[model samples]
Target: MPVVLSLNVARKTIPVDYARAGATGIDKRPVDGPLRVSPTEAKGTAGSGVAGDSIGDWTVHGGEYQAVYGYAREDLDWWQSELDVPLSNGQFGENLTTQGIDHTTALVGEHWRIGSALLEVTGPRIPCRTFAEFLGQRGWVKRFTQQARPGAYFRVLEEGLIGPGDEISVVHRPGHDVTVELCFRALTTEAALLPRLLAAGDSVPPEVVELVHKRSVVELDS
Candidate 1:
């Protein structure tokens, strides 16, 4: 019944490292300042058009997904309020900013929209070293991740241009039994409890898939 919406999204001035290596075929142009640019630029293999796979567009995990990162309003407010900052200032490099939803409590496989782009909640972004760099704080990597609700990232099923000021709202919540919160709990408080959660066989990342495979009690496939 609640609607999840994106109020703001701040893409990294430096696109994800993988995106730059032509892995995602997204070119980088120093986001922010006069030279700020989006992550859609491709000047690599796709640039030559010789590669059969058209690597000039954003691809996730070698086409696993196009766009990979998102944030929710609740995460913003909690983090920002603690830091004493405004949510619109663009402190984080996360794209697909959000409003009206608490990503921490959101369920995996949930649906939402930003303009014409539809996104499904795939998983929580495992904090990378880059995220720490963005914060300009030592141990921020550990601190930020500890709070959970690291924000949602998705595999894009539809391709469309997304930018700031786009209104985001929820479309539906899948009837999956396992939820993102459970995954977060597994990753966080119940890290030692992973065997049980993975045994649940819910939505999770590929990296976790292997980890879960070993611990899964029942036959799990997804």
Candidate 2:
């Protein structure tokens, strides 16, 4: 079972006042950093990326040790040692930082328990131009899209307070036959496979599953 060994939220919101931000429509953004947590129920915005009321909740796949999100993994000095770019911190804007989990293989509808906090798997990370502004790179959105390992965004099935060093684990993984990556693609491109993916028709998120149905080129008998 994957579980979180540690979690974190901004000790203080970092500053990201890009000088060219106005030109890019990306300025005065608060960069969340060091969001270590002790594990607790997710309580806050639904789709707004702000975990807690201030931010949002995050979950790991299965219940493996802990889960890791945000730019920490890609930007931290330790991780930077492994990368050529040596990225900066506060890129993920995550409410929770976790360890020991393979989020990519995590299927949708998975539920997790961190300390007393319970979260339900809702969807995948939505890419946009805003993220690219931070990297000063074009196609950053497409790069993430190609990777298809975007972490999961969870909804608070239950609510509670959490701090640093909480044990997080999957409470349940609804026996769905779909992987997180496939879920992402269905929402973006290659939506044609949704029917074959869902197999259950309307069970999956309509925004995702039905998006394909709406665009489906396959002829259906009336």
Candidate 3:
């Protein structure tokens, strides 16, 4: 059974001089006990958890579609070798550090029952300037994108409490065959995979479908 290895949240944003100057929510710390999870009420909405867990950039961070972010402990282990540094839970800015699950193979629209909350996989985490700044690695965005295992973003279907050690079980999986890794590849490295994304049908969010269509056009034109 997959389990929540750690529950993390950024109580407050940290200021940085890099592209993410004002404050970024990329810094997260593990915490014990149950933490509330809910969809962001509005852009820049904070305080969606029992603690002060909040999203820094409302324009692109927190929302109903990406209420929670999850990463695999296995991936962290792999990065630990590459970065030659001891990485801890939430080091990648994930709300849940999960164990015993292959996030890359996790399908979009798959439902996970964790604690009392129900979550649906929405898409893959696309590497961005904030993530690059957080990691502080040269060409981190491109490097991470090339890695092609961008974890998973989840939408909260049933708001509830979650905590470390909570068991996570798959309640449902959509018929779509598109996995999270495939989506990341389609979005980043391989334009040829864009048309294949539509095979997932409604399982893929409309916004992502739009991106896929745009990519498909560019792939054909190029």
TM-score to native of every candidate shown: 0.62, 0.63, 0.89
Q: What does the lDDT come to for candidate 1?
A: 0.49
- Give Cα-based local distance difference scores for all models: 0.49, 0.47, 0.82
Model with the higher lDDT, candidate 1 or 2: 1
TM-score of 1: 0.62
lDDT of 1 by residue, 91-179 (tens): 45444455566666667666666555666666665654555654556787678767776776555444444444555667777655556
Candidate 2 residue-wise lDDT, 1-222, digit = tens: 343433433332224443222222112123332222223332221222223222212221211112223222322344345334644323454445455665556666666676565665555666656556556666767877776756665555554544445556776776666766677787667765566556433324444554556656554633
Model 3 lDDT per residue over 149-173, tens place: 7999887788788999999999898
On TM-score, the candidate that comes out on top is 3
Model 3 TM-score is 0.89
lDDT of 2 at 27: 21
RMSD of 1: 7.8
Stretches of candidate 3 off by over 4 Å are 41-51, 215-222
In lDDT terms, how accurate is model 2? 0.47
Give the candidate order by descending TM-score: 3, 2, 1
Better of 1 and 3 by lDDT: 3
